[model samples]
Target: MSKLSEKASEYLSREERLNVLSTSNKAGENNIAVFGSVMAVDDSTVMLMLGENTTCANLRENPRAALLVYVPGKGGLQAEGCRVYLRLRAMEDTGERFEQIKAGIRARVGDAADMLKHLAIFEVLKVRPIIDLGQEI
Candidate 1:
């Protein structure tokens, strides 16, 4: 159970934003997808929506991922820019925490979110900030 910094946590949950999820299989095939359902389970832990597809399969083979999350300017030139590179280690389980994650997905997206089956439970290994020029604008 790892936790993210307060700032990182706030950024992830501030609004539903798109992030890039990159994973690779044991054979080294790259898989990338745009995910918007990322959320911090707590401070050091995060959860993502997994579909029955390539991204999930990649994680099944290699439980590692790098998620790129960037927040665009809020108003024209005033919003501060923030970008993060998140290192994650994922697992599949139906344990208590997984259930909590399931509950969260349903709560956020409603019953239509049932397409989610397995929980890509991940621990935040690292949080690297990437400076963007837009923020300085």
Candidate 2:
């Protein structure tokens, strides 16, 4: 496995623990929602599941997306200007990658296997990390 920077790894892990904001396309507009199970596959890639919703529909039409996540808890690291831009690729209904991701999800959220069995897996490509530090901490 490729290793990520300390800061990047910390940010990704923290984001995995919290709900992430996923932005997709709509009818000439933008649709954003909170997703509970966003995960990082590597320093430059993320994986998520999309169901039959406006977000999924929009992704089918326009695959570009942005994800935002922040740290949680008191005295947690403040993350405001951090974002990830992804060029959405293929959406998998079922495959080896899907099983791998599902296993990872099961590790995080127990008892979600059956419920998520029908969800579609999305593979994101060319993810670019954008972080802006407002002030020195």
Candidate 3:
């Protein structure tokens, strides 16, 4: 597995950022959803709390996915962002990790935590600039 670059890691840590997870089913039907429960567990891993929805179902059907993280700028490609390719590593509905994530969600968004049904763990496959101008992440 490859590691995330320092810049990419920093961008993923931004509190005021946008995260959109893209996944496709076994038949290649695509799905994208805005997520607020995403966090970089380290440079090589990311974790998310997901309900039993299309996103979770798609990941189970096809492990490949991508997370587009963006931190808005005044305007243009100069914006801070990166496209993080990921592979589903694990999905746990019960465990220490799940409980921890559940508590975190409760603290941040109260009742929204009740909707969390799975703790999704993913391995970072690659990271690229949002515009993909042949620039390094």
**The best candidate in terms of lDDT:** 3
Candidate 1: residue 60 Cα off by (Å):
0.9
Taking the tens digit of each residue's C-alpha lDDT, what string does model 3 give over 1-137?
77889988888888889999999999999999999999888999998999999999999999999999999874586778899999999999998879987998899899988989999999999888988889788
> For candidate 2, lDDT tens digit of each residue in 29-123?
77887766566666655667655677777777777776665555433343332455666656776888777777777887787554554333334
What is candidate 1's lDDT per residue for 43-120, written digit by digit as tens?
A: 777778776889888887887787776676564543432343344465555678677777877897898567776777
Candidate 1 — which pairs collide?
A: 2-44, 3-43, 3-44, 4-43, 4-44
Runs off by more than 4 Å, candidate 3 = none
lDDT of 1: 0.69
Whole-model lDDT per candidate? 0.69, 0.58, 0.91
Output the lDDT of residue 132, model 3. Answer: 88
In model 2, which runs have C-alpha deviations exceeding 4 angstroms?
1-6, 74-81, 106-137
Report RMSD (Å) for each prediction in the order shown.
4.1, 4.9, 0.9
Between candidates 1 and 2, which one is better according to TM-score? Answer: 1
